[model samples]
Target: MLYFDESGYTGPDLINSKQPYFSLASIRMTDEEIAQIKEEVGYCEWGRELHFKSMYKSYHGQKILDKIFNHPLMDNYHVLPSFAHKRYCIYANIVNILVETMYHFNGINLYEGAKNLILANGLHCFAILHSNKDLVAEFENNFVGMVRKPSIESVANFYRTTDKLRYDVDTREGFFDMLSEIPPTIQYIKEALTHKKFYIDLTIPLFSVSIQEWYNKTKVKENVLFDSSEPFFANIEFMESLRDMEVPETVVGYGKGKHVYPLPVGNMEIAKSHEEFGIQLADVFASALCFALTPRNDKFVKYQDKIKSLPIFQNIKLNIAPSTNDFIEARMKETAEIDPLDFLCEHSDRININKKSNI
Candidate 1:
């Protein structure tokens, strides 16, 4: 069983400046294993539930965290986490909402041959390089508005900003075809706006990514627990549906990142963190990793020192926010490395995008 907990959850407001990243961590252990870990870290001495922030504050607390993060059981292969940069979540959403809608309208399989990843990363790298914050902010705000209420104004604004962005950069490398169909896609969004099923909160998609990661690692139905302290009220129903659902191979193929089981999931529940030692450790990992990724935080350095180099075999760290060009380049390179032939053949249209330019 794996106990899951998260840090930096601001509902669907992914662009909230106060918390730019969300981290979800899970540790797999049996009851006996949890007891062993608690004993190893002297968790019972606290006489209360182990909370990460309070424990991370004091010198003694830091020592305890050091012991917990470095415990023999929490080895490199055991640490599993899913980290999402909120802004990047929106970036990917912009592509998925607009471009994926376009593809669906045209009866094309965006997910086939991993084209979704290629286009999302391609659009993101190009937008950050060529588009200014105001332009991007307009696009992002319109997206949030459209999802929340689906206003005609929001769609119009989004369409205008998207239209400008598409032409701003040369489209030879990127999928301009997706952009060309924006009008029809906007019409689709307008019609579907009233359907609650169509407008998923930002948290749902990123949370889905994490759930898939968990199932991918375990590949079996297992008990997954979440810290009830942070209310992901939106996640509960979606999670329940995942366990009960199944799909045909044509709809979703089985593979490393794809769903192996029809609808990969097991039993998932919510529990108080204080009552669950495994959940508490997940809290530690989520908070520490979230803080460590934020450059301005002083604990960023100290926290990274304590948590770095841990064995993390299954993870999702979506750091697509604009930090450096190298960050974008490195991730794109990883996509290519995953399936060089598929990437080469499928992304032939994007060959020029692989090159760097002033635009």
Candidate 2:
């Protein structure tokens, strides 16, 4: 079974500047494998008696860290400060390692190598679970004999009600708290009981890491206008494009104005202008993707510098232009006069224009 998800987000941080990290995590495992992992972790045996907090102290102490650090898998991946800063890096590194461990056990990575394995084996009716509806649609469009199911409710409920005893202390309590509140999706391989033969593939993460490294190392330049704020909010034209493409399934959960939760194409609910949302999204994506590739938690500024050095990151940034002050002011005015929904629905093609006639 393939369970895919992205993490490190709680709510849209349009106005707030405190939270620093956002990420995505995907896990692929069979029912039996999940059970076996749970057993190995003593989660099944301990039941609710052991909470994540206590479990971390009891099971994954300094001794466990030593073992993991010395393990062969640690050769390429470093455990020290996952990122640049000391505090944030530590937390980020721990989460990265945990996700890495899960992927190692299941032989899957971010680049969809596991799915390739399933496809190569003539596997059909593969279940794909993800929180992002757009991602689900993308997968469905690309793959034949694939089934998509929304599991946000199930995953959220599990995190909410499950006794903390089942998890480790170092686990972000806020993550569990948020998961308990939001809906999550889960995917799996169908008819695995009948066809037990399967091969586990483990090259995707390396591929992603390598690609990221390559991107970071490469350099290119282009002439581009600055539209800083557009990347944060969902552009009306972009949303229309997706809809015209017959991709409305990507719109899941209640969005603010025309802006959706998981995808770009909606407005920033709290911000005075759509441009702000674009900036925020750009920052979030840059931070998350960098964290994913680097496996080290660095501050946003430092990460930005590192990303600037990468070819792919440079390409992405080059595409992002800063919003002009005139655009910002006009958006603020528009937002003040209209209800978000009405504005989103009615002003589809309208870009805010300043009365001053400044470009």
List candidate 2 segments past 4 Å from native: 5-7, 14-18, 49-359
Query: For residues 1-359, what per-residue lDDT tens digits would candidate 1 score against the true structure?
Result: 87777888776676578787877777778788888888888887866777777877788888888888778888534557767777766756665666666676678756555566655666556555543667666666767667666666777777787777566554433545545545567757743454444243444444555656666666656677778854455567655644443333112332333333233556778888778888888888888777666666464475565455455523345333333555434433332223322332334324334333425
Candidate 2, residue 194: Cα displacement in angstroms equals 50
Per-residue alpha-carbon lDDT of model 2 for 201-278, expressed as tens digits?
A: 111222122223222333211111112223213233333332233223232212111222112222212233122222
The lDDT per prediction is 0.62, 0.27
Model 2, 350: alpha-carbon shift in Å?
20
Q: What lDDT does candidate 2 reach at residue 339?
A: 31
Residue 254 alpha-carbon offset, candidate 2, angstroms:
30
Number of the top-ranking candidate, with TM-score as the measure: 1
Q: How good is model 2 by TM-score?
A: 0.22
